[model samples]
Target: MNTSPTNSDSDTLRVLAQAIAKLILRFRFSRSRFLTLLDEELVLQAKNNDPQANNVTLSIRTGINRRYIPQLLSGEAMHSKPERLKMILEDLKWTSQKHYQSGKVPLKGSFNTFETICELRASGTLTYKAILEELMKQGKVKVAGNKVEIISNNSEQDNEHREFARNSVEKVFYTVEEIIQTEKN
Candidate 1:
């Protein structure tokens, strides 16, 4: 198989890569995290096409390690791992750990609750109530009576985040495929 990129191909690829890098930087993603996400997308692509796709083939195609491919393709991997929707959830969890001390806290308080945590974590432009509402909307937190509980353990939020990330990756892949098809035309 002869594979050589033309000048046009390289230029297009460079633009696409820079665009993706900009997104990664915007999300503050680490290199390992980006690699893991890339691995997950490749594994998902393989699985959709072939249920019995082996790790060796995936590793060869994706340039990811054979051992890593299995984990990326595992039944739990897609659902258990949080992807792009990590920031708010992570902040909430951090607050729960650092301020709550116990697993629960008052829903609205001067300290150690949604108000205080949000105050500390949220930017000056955003208020604590807004963040609390977002968390509740995302199902990452529950408010009962005067208390708010953060689902700190590996919870439904992670699944939602992973699902969102997978959908996003699928969209990007679809767009890239469309570009390739257009280039061929």
Candidate 2:
């Protein structure tokens, strides 16, 4: 994997930071809360990238408190159940694309089942049952008598959730464009 940051990556980071700053300002979010949330996100990202990642590794990589890593992973910190489920859904989508033969796949008797995918992506932090429950709640997956069917990848979420995610992404792009124009001027 190329670890070097390209110009585009740097620009994206700048825009992401600006958007986060704007959101913080708009919401008047406390600095401690922001840092905690950021830490949780970083920890999860690290775990996803490296399945062997642990509290010590995450602390070293993210400068977060080692003590809180367990709490964050266990959903005790900020209730990250939704985020965990979303990550599982993303992994399922990717795995399905790469391994499954069709839109529907078997729940068992396959290496790329939903449970196995969750086990691989979550690195044991998230349980298959938990992810299944969340997916069921969102109507993203259905369990029949024996097989499981993926209704959606959780990409097209509810309107409110979708709009919130879209706005956050748009804010980053707008901020980046503004910055580029300012620099050119």
Candidate 3:
């Protein structure tokens, strides 16, 4: 099965959102060597490219305030809302489809209530709950009553925990593969 991100419309939206984010960062830092006119042209291009795209939804996805959408679009604001931006990005590439498809195996712990976990499961990853469990185990996610939440708002730390969990998963998979190979021998 093709698991490419391009297969889903959400993927397009995700990419667009990310690109916009980069633009926001560039605009904020005032480091653009290009002329101000060029920067203005870029923002206008972005605005024109997706005027129909729900700005409010994008705000929700990016964790930016809906009211700020006008400001961001107007070139009055430069900084992206860091928290919401991370959530939306996470929603885009949070999990593999295979894990959700199985529907039997449990996740670690942290992914239980993640907004994207259920969607990932629907897309064929492990069940959302299973992913949540695994996330909790590694401290990447926190949960109460099946609703997974982020324990730390720190993006760097969250990324680190995710890496740790991925590594742990790989090690476990290797062990299982070894056992299977031994049995076959």
Worst 10 residues of 3 by lDDT: 26-35
TM-score pick, better of 2 and 3: 2
Strongest candidate by TM-score: 1
Rank order by TM-score, top first?
Answer: 1, 2, 3
* Whole-model lDDT per candidate: 0.68, 0.71, 0.50
Candidate with more favorable, higher lDDT: 1 or 2: 2
Better model by TM-score: candidate 1 vs candidate 3: 1
How does each model score on TM-score?
0.43, 0.39, 0.23
RMSD in order of candidates: 8.9, 15.3, 19.6
Error of 3 at 40 (Å): 36
Q: Candidate 3, after superposition: displacement of residue 39 in Å?
A: 36
1-185: candidate 3 lDDT, tens digit per residue: 75444545576557545644554453332223223434445445555767676766656444555666665567774543344323432552333224443212222344532444455434464555565555566555555453344454588876886676566546655765686588579
**Best-to-worst ranking by lDDT:** 2, 1, 3
lDDT of 2 by residue, 1-185 (tens): 77789998798788678877876655434456667677778888888888798789988777778988887777575643345566666776676667775555456654878778777767668777787876787678888755567785454556656578568757766877897788789
lDDT of 2: 0.71
What is the C-alpha lDDT profile of model 1 across 106-142, one tens digit per residue? 7676766667655665558677677677667766677
